[model samples]
Structure formats: C-alpha cells, structure tokens
Target: MATFAMSDQLLVIIDPAARQTDGESVRIAKDVLSAGAAAKVCLPDGPAEFARALGRRGSRRPVVIGDDHALLRAVTLLHRERELAGCGLSVVPVGEAGETSLTQSLGVPGGAVAAARAVLDGTERRLDLLVDDSDGVVLTGLAIPPARRVPAPEPVASAAGRWYRTLLARTLPARPPRLPAVPAPGPTRLRVQLDGETLVDLDEPLESLTVTPGAPGTSGGGTAEVEFRPLSVGAEATPLRACGRTVTVTGPDFRYRADGAVSGPVRRRTWRLAEAAWGLVLPS
Candidate 1:
C-alpha cells in the first residue's frame, strides 16, 4: 500500500447519473476534493464521453464520482488497456444505498464528504479481479443464474382500502421490518468445473451458483471462492463450496449477473482470477 500526498494531480470524473441523482452530494464531493488537491473535474454526459475522459488522463490519478456502475466502467476500461495494475482508482459513491453496495463492500466510505476526503488522504491497496474469457472484468462476485424478477402486487379496487393501506404505511417506521424474500428455486442444470476438476455434472439440477474473488489480505494471490446449491429431492442438500484459481461452466444457454449487470445466454463461460490485478484507494 502507498499513501497519496495532497499535491498529487487528480482527474475527477463525475458520472451523469450522480449529477441527476444527487447534485448536492456531487457538489460537496467536488468542493472537498478540489480544496485538497490539484484536481481537474470532468462532467461526461454519457458512456462515450466517460471513456474518452478516462483515456485522456495523463499522469493524474483517476477518481470517480458516481455509483457502482460508473466505478465498474472505469475499472473495466483500465483493465482492457492493461493499465489497471499501475493506476490507483478512487471513488465517491453517489446514489441510493442499495445501488452503491458494491463500492461499500470494497471498503469505500459511505458519504460523499468522507469518501472525497479519503481520496486525498487514503492509501492505495492492490485488489483482486476476475476476468472472464470474453474479456469481461468482475470487480466483485458474480452469480450464475440471474435473480428472478417478482411481479408487483395487484392494485386495490376500493378507494377506501387504498386509503387505509396508505395510512398504515405512513404510521409504520421509515423502514418497516420485513423478511428477505426467498427466491423460489427454478430448474437449472450446469456443469461446473474448478481448476479443471468437475465439481458438479450436468445431470444434477442446480439451484444457484456464485463466484467471488479473494480479498486483499488473503494468502493466495490468484484464487476465488465458488459455491453452488444442488436442487434437493426430499430434503435441502448442502451447498458444495471450493476455492480455486479458475472456474468453468458449461450447459444450456443461461444468463448470469456480474456486478449487478446481466449478460449472456452463452452455452459456456470461464473465469480466471487475476492476482493484484488492480489498485483501489481506501482509508488507512
């Protein structure tokens, strides 16, 4: 890990989503960052402009001011250019709490002010990455079968019932306690292999599969945790788990979710762990 000085040059790329979602937070982030460093701000309107701004950054450190998607975009670009290992990326998460969960999971501070200050005073920590065969990068973990979508509830017919429900909602706490929805299992068959050894065969029905990159301070440099649940017959079967450097999946066309984005209906896919493939700035 390496600490950054206040005099360092920074290229601050503010995502358009952040501006539209929370202008005040973005402004505060800009104020703090500019006050502490030699910062050049870029307000890119779309994906093309965003890539251009990042590509044009010379010796300046790149700092992203947006949600997880923006951060993923920056990392993916740098990884594609083979510059991710050398560049230390910083992010100021700006969006709904759920939307920025990936950034938080990677140890970034929550608020705009705190995250911005970290950019000036934090240390650069090397992080692991999972790169797929298609050149897709996964900053965080990915799920084999994408989450199922639940339809919205039917609207009430009576206006009086609607009013009563509205009143009940208002009377409850800001976030009323509710149990997490358990997704009903669907029929999915996938052949999973770890490090070239088969973990599960195509004959078995798979309920879910997940792959996550190893954390920073772990012993192995290039390794990821893999877990998958086999659909049980009478009783719920225990999920099989393993840690390895590479994972391969083959079966019928299936979609997967990586870093909150959905992709593929491809028949086969493989991912290999890249040890210390990127750097992220985090608080000391």
Candidate 2:
C-alpha cells in the first residue's frame, strides 16, 4: 500500500441514515479513522445540523461517513460556499449497496475498513461538477426519466431473523429510504439544446435524456455530455449524443435524477460544466 503523509486534522461527519441503516459499519469506520488519524466525529441528525457541522469545521479535512446522499450534501454545501476547488473530500459508504452507488462509481472502496483507511492514506483527485442555473450541483451524472428505486431485498427467513429485521426497521434511520417506483408520466415533447445548437426540437417527443460531465468531441475536454433517445423507432436514429459546455432541457414538466436525488417538474432547466470544480480522495 502506498503510504501518504497523513494529515492530522480530520473531521468525520456521520449521516443519520448511515448510522440507522448500518450502525456496525459506521462504528467500524469510526474506529478505523480514530485510530489512524486525529479524527473528530460528528453525528448530525438532520440536514440543518449536517450543514452546521460542515460549516463549523476549521482546518480539518471533512470526511463524510454515509451513503451517496451524504456525499451529495457535503459537495453541495461546499459548492455553494465556493470552497469546493480547494477542499478534498472523503467518504465511507455505510448504507445498502444500492444507496452507495455514487461513491462506488467514484472509486471509493466499498468496505468500511478500506474506505476509512483510504481517508487517511488516499491521494487527492480533481473532478468536474455540473452546476445548474438554480445553483444546484451534480457530483455524479444525472439521468432523464430519472431512476426507478431499487426494490428492497427479500425478507430474511426464520422467526428469529424476522424479529431482528423488524427491530432494525423500527430502530434505525429507515434504511436510507427510497421512493416507490412510479410509472413514467408518458412521453413528453422536449426542446434540447447543446451549447446554442438545437438537438431535439419541441415537436420531437423524447423517451429519455442524460447529461454528464465530459465533452462531446473526438478530443475529450471540459464539457457536458448530453444524450437523448427519441420515441420514434428509426434504426438510423440511434440515441443522439453530443458534447458541450451547456445543455438546456425544456419541457412541460419533467423530473430528473441528479446524483442520487430526484428533482424537477419544472418547465426548463440548464446545466453547465464546472471543470475541476472539486477534489475527492481515492485510494493511492
């Protein structure tokens, strides 16, 4: 393993959902961090407290111990304060596998021990972000049509197991709850614009769309990738893909999954790439 010059200052924020869903994992992560570094752990029950914990952090490097939502909250907070570029964030995923997809995608270790060790020994990596006109931030890719909630796993067998599960349900933060999947609202006409060029006009009905950080050219550069699929079944009309610094999506009212959060029902939304706007710590 590559040894890093460990920074003594570290503040670990444990999300309530993480503590509720998998207290054991959170505890293991806490133990690892505390033993390896000068770690100060904070347990925030709600969003307000979460923000306050981060705001009060002094020179300590902020480490979030939770699922994707926890990481998103931290990144959004830093982005809004315009401190993202200089901050290096670390995360230890402590929820169900489905709930921690964002962290996994970003190359964070899945196991609590590994993730915690990475916090103390990882190298910093610069990453891009997507910022909307409303000042919202997207650390991971956003999807059109949004994502359907991952169905809960089958219940455990045996009476004793069932009782233990039930106890957890009542006592925990709620297993990082997911919204029950709702049927799509039907095909909607949308006007998709890349940079200033029109990709999908208002007359064209779109089945779905996705915007991600990356440029749309032979040379990969700073830009957002915009892609959409039309409802029409044309072999020649495969999914339309393009790259640009800005992408605008306008429809009657539609929802999108940004990072892991679902948002929308607005008539218009614009997203632009903020290249290397933030840094994340990954295993060296």
Candidate 3:
C-alpha cells in the first residue's frame, strides 16, 4: 500500500448539497482535516464553481467532503481533462446512508469522524473505471430500465378554448392530428454482448440488467460483472452472469442508471473497463 504523510497540503471541496443538507457533518470534516494537515476549504455553489475549484488546484491534493454524486462529479471532471490517473482522490462522504451507497461499498466509512480520519490517515489504491463511448464515466455500477421519469400532465383546455378548437376542427380538414406520447413499456427486450459472446440476445425479454465492477481476481479489475434476468411466466428464471472487459446492450430505446445518475434512451450503448485508471484513498 502506498502512503502519504498527514502534513501534506490538502484542498477540500464541499458540495453545496452536503453543506445544505448537513452543516454539522461539514464542520466535523473540516476540523478533522485541518487538525492533521494544512487544509483549505472551498464551497462550490454549483457545477461550474465545482469545476473551477478542481481545475485551479495547485500542488494540494484535493479531497471531497460530500456524497457519491459530488465524488462522481469531481472524478468525471478530472477524467475529461485526462488528469484522473495522476490525481489521487479522497472522499469524506457526507450524506444520508441511502445517498452515499457508492462510498460505503468502496470501504469508506459512513460516519463523519471515521471517514474524515481515514482521509488523513489512509493509503492510496488504484481502481478501475467504466468508460462509455459517449464519453460518460461510471465508478460503481450501472443498471438498465432506469427509474421512470414521470412526465408532467398536459394543460387542460378551457371551455372557450375547447369550443374554439372544435369550431376550427369543423371548418378545416384536419391534417393528421398529433396525439400525446404513449409511455414506453416496462421489462423490455435487450440484446447483451459480453466481450464478443452473446449473453442475452434480442429474442429474449429481460426484466432487468446490471453491470458492476468485478473484484480484482475476477478479471484483473478490468472487467464488469454482467447479469440479466429473463422475464418468464412460470418460475423465475435464474439470472445469467458473466465478466468481460467490454459489455454492449441494444434493443428498442432504453435508459440506464449509473452511479445514481440517469442517462440515455439510445438504441445501443457500450461500456469498456479501464483497469486501475485512478487511485482512491482508503483506510489501510
């Protein structure tokens, strides 16, 4: 394990959500970090400021005092700049348990004191990242048939407006009338390809799909765990699981949730693993 001294200069970035949602946690994190090192704190109100804070970082190692989304945002920004590999990140996750699942899974402590202390006393370990063709990056996991985004209801027509529309309809030969959009169906059919072998083809309807970073020995941390459940009427079919460096999914337009953020509706998407592309600070 690679270690760094506690006296290293540190730049701490506090996400607005964390400070707004939990002020005490932020204070605790600041106290913990300052006690061990020369620490400077920056409060970024929005995404733009967040990027500026990271972009302007000097020799100080950057640490995030926020939840999973904040951590992902920082990582994504660094990835875009091609500096992720050179910069080792530390996270003192400050949010509700449900909101910081990714940090917890990565072995970061959930409590403020423990996580902050780890940030100062931890060792750095390299980790893999999932890069998509669209230039999006994922840290933890990706799942399909994302949580549906309910559309706002259309405005109702007033009595006078309705009457006017009716009169206009009677006077003019209506070109094909536009109808409201129908929602896409749930439990869709998807064709999944792992590395070059087809796992679930378009012929089979799928209930759901998940792809997570595989363990170190599973595939050298350069492969993802791909699993899909088949929709069936009888007993539930056993899910199919495989690992590969690249995973592709296609079939009618669909969306996916990656690291808690929803993206897509495209007909096809592919994610390739970059082995140990970045380093994370964790308790030794």
* Alpha-carbon local distance difference test for all models: 0.88, 0.82, 0.84
Q: Write the per-residue lDDT of candidate 1 for residues 1-284, one digit (tens) a residue.
A: 88999999999999999999999999999999999999999999999999999999999999999999999999999998988888989999998669899998898999999999999999888888899999999878899763565544454456678788788678976654444655755668889999999988899888889998987433235789998887764227666789999999999998899989889888999999998888899988
The prediction achieving the highest TM-score against the true structure is 1
Query: Which stretch of 10 consecutive residues in model 3 shows the poorest summed lDDT?
Result: 214-223
TM-score for predicted model 3 compared with the true structure = 0.82
TM-score result, candidate 2: 0.81
lDDT, ranked from best to worst: 1, 3, 2
Candidates 2 and 3 compared: the better one by lDDT is: 3
Segments of candidate 2 deviating more than 4 angstroms: 1-4, 146-186, 215-220, 233-237
lDDT per residue, candidate 2, 237-256, as tens digits? Answer: 77778888888888778788
Q: Name the lDDT of candidate 1.
A: 0.88
Could you report the Cα RMSD, in angstroms, for every candidate shown?
Answer: 6.1, 8.3, 7.1
Better of 2 and 3 by TM-score: 3
- Taking the tens digit of each residue's C-alpha lDDT, what string does model 3 give over 82-117? 999999899999886688888778878889899888
Q: Is candidate 1 or candidate 2 better by TM-score?
A: 1
* Preferred candidate (TM-score higher): 1 or 3: 1
TM-score of each: 0.85, 0.81, 0.82
